[model samples]
Target: MPIIDKEGNFLAVADNVETISNSAAIADVMAQFANAEILGIIFPTHHDGRGYSLTKKLRRAGFNGKLRAIGPLIPDQFSDLIACGFDEIEISDEQFLRQPLVQWLAAKEISQHSYQNNNSTKTSIFQSRRQKIAANRHLNLVRELP
Candidate 1:
């Protein structure tokens, strides 16, 4: 659902910082990102992927304040969005009507693993399988050694 409503149920606090540029120095916002009560990144369109990269960068930079994604995004990307450190997603009414909450929730479970170095969830099938194989091998060695 949209983050904000006509009645004002859910909302994001606007930052007082003046200039926020994609290519600007993120160091400039270290203090603001830390001190601000709320912070967010807006994706003008689905094609613009700066938000995804920026979200990870902000979180890593220690922006513990509220992080929200404001744009029209597909339900399938919800998990990645959250994993990248988004607390909530703000989409248009038309987007909500088409996908709805159920669709988003379902999309959240689309993948159990992420190939990205930094993400919300840590469930990678390849990594998981490797760990299991190592554990099983260790167990077999112990059983034979005694």
Candidate 2:
């Protein structure tokens, strides 16, 4: 995932995302949401309350991924974000890397529930494809391990 700084410049691209300390223009940032390889957003401190509103809009606009609060975000705001559809969080670099595993587990759990619920045929098909990819990767890892 790549992080963009406040000036709309590329900051870093890695398997994980880190804190974005710079303030970005919310409109421009949200425009990147559809095409950005970014897995999350990190709202910096000292800006207007645009970041929270941006995240809420992103979720409403169909961003089905992580939405993180980087600087000056208190724990009390977690539930609010969750209510708005923010999934994973990145409190630190370590937490960011670990988030993929958490997401994988969550996906697996949700897939199970979805199978039981029998709703959203499209989602079931997508989840089956995702599970197949995961299983294939696991088999590759196991093959490489020994």
Candidate 3:
């Protein structure tokens, strides 16, 4: 399995990662895994979205460690996964071969702007629209004053 950062950089896999299944309850393991240096959330399948929910819970619980999503996932989901708080994604060799590094990079580029805010650094469509509206309103007001 090859691990990739959100920026599409190939990352050296950490040997000391604490693994947890997506099905595990966050409340049950919060004390143990929350303080881990690195945590790996096992996603049995891309279709299983429990991992995303779990990640959110862990983050809210103050799990500030490196969070890794390990499973079979497509390049399309890269942005959503990052927004969901995954620091790195571990993909199978077959998926890597099929999608290639370029696809992952492209996905990262596309993630720069998104429709939903989701607490990510990327600017949301709503926020951009609001900024533009405010600028236009300011310009209109200035014209009226003159």
TM-score of each model, in listed order: 0.76, 0.39, 0.89
Q: Which should have the higher TM-score, number 1 or number 3?
A: 3
In model 2, where do residues sit more than 4 Å from their true spots?
Answer: 1-14, 18-27, 35-38, 46-48, 92-146
Angstrom error at residue 68, model 1: 0.5
Model 3 lDDT at residue 95: 87
lDDT of each: 0.66, 0.47, 0.86
- Per-residue error for 113 in candidate 1, Å, reads 3.4
- Residue-level error in angstroms, candidate 3, position 100: 1.7
Q: Which lDDT tens digits does candidate 1 get at residues 65-138?
A: 77667777777777777777777767888987887776776666556567654455475667778899999999
Compose the digit string of candidate 3's lDDT tens values, residues 1-146.
78888777987655778899998987876867768888999989889999998898888888888899999988888888889989889988888989888898887776587788775678889999999999999999999994
lDDT of model 3 at position 138:
96
Arrange candidates by lDDT, highest first: which order?
A: 3, 1, 2
- Candidate 2: minimum summed lDDT over ten consecutive residues — where? 113-122
Q: lDDT at 3 for candidate 2?
A: 31
